[model samples]
Target: MGYPQVSAREQIIPSRVPTDAKANALEIGPERTVIEITHVGVTAEGRAVKVTIAVAPVHYLTAGYELRSPDTRRSQTDDHASR
Candidate 1:
């Protein structure tokens, strides 16, 4: 078989936030989110691949929030779809 093609990979290339951007803390509000582009590697001889090898801001459940929930229902508690 032949190799796959490098399709268009869309990304949000925002300006790097400074240290004092949010008083030295990345505050992910209820409607806010954060992500990190972990690595960009080439595979199978120049097949470009971008890997976001990181998790969200709230990786751990400090408060009464759950780290992993199977609740697929949509509610006002924690809406996955922002809009």
Candidate 2:
């Protein structure tokens, strides 16, 4: 493939608080939710092979984790799936 396709992507993949649905998450801020500006780049050279890029956000150090219990972790997982 040579620059044939560009897929649709969602801007805001919202995350809610474990206990409350109305609360905002620490990872994604309320002010930075909407993307005000964007920059796009294209390859100067045409490629023959297809390109698939997979990206994930991993947090190595969270500010608050001492307060979370084992049950809380389970609830957060459950809440994430249900929402």
Candidate 3:
């Protein structure tokens, strides 16, 4: 048997920055907040299987000050992964 053909599509939903004073002070900025992925497999029957994935950002920690220190810079994986 051989592997079936597959097609995939991914979309990054746009984000809107909050206008409220408290929200803005919290450093909540415009970021790609949502991602949607769709996969489709094809076979002799025409359409074989379909799958979809929706991803969102999860804030493990919310601090009043920045987490990264000036002495040591850290990768912004948390922000980028959501996109």
Candidate 4:
């Protein structure tokens, strides 16, 4: 959690990940290369919040894999989850 703080707009809902990484794709799934942490609480200003953070090794994502957009990767995850 050494990362920077999220703005107010990002404090409530979880994002529609697999997040896009531009030219660098983020690969996640059976390899378990991605790690996510979620926290649900109230902000100091008293707004309810839920947050999720995703962590991955840059070396593996940018390494040898054929890069694909998160839109493409999201479906793969959804397909697997449906099974």
Superposed model 4: Cα runs more than 4 Å off: 1-24, 27-32, 43-47, 57-83
lDDT of predicted model 3: 0.43
Clash counts for all predictions: 0, 0, 0, 0
- Model 2, span 1-83: residue lDDT tens: 54643322223223222222211433443333222112232344533234333222222222232354779889999999999
TM-score of each: 0.22, 0.20, 0.27, 0.22
Q: What does candidate 3's lDDT look like per residue over 1-75, in tens digits?
A: 565655333343433333354345455444423322344556555654555643333242222533545444334
lDDT of 1 by residue, 1-50 (tens): 45554432335433233334442365544444444334445555667665
> What value does the lDDT take at residue 26 in candidate 3?
50
Off-target runs (Cα >4 Å) in candidate 1 are 1-29, 48-50, 58-83
Winner on TM-score (2 vs 3) = 3
- Each prediction's RMSD to truth: 15.3, 18.6, 16.8, 17.0
Question: How does model 3 score by TM-score?
Answer: 0.27
Best by lDDT: 4
lDDT of 3 at 51: 55
Ten-residue segment with the worst summed lDDT in candidate 1? 14-23
Q: Which ten residues in a row have the lowest lDDT in candidate 4?
A: 6-15
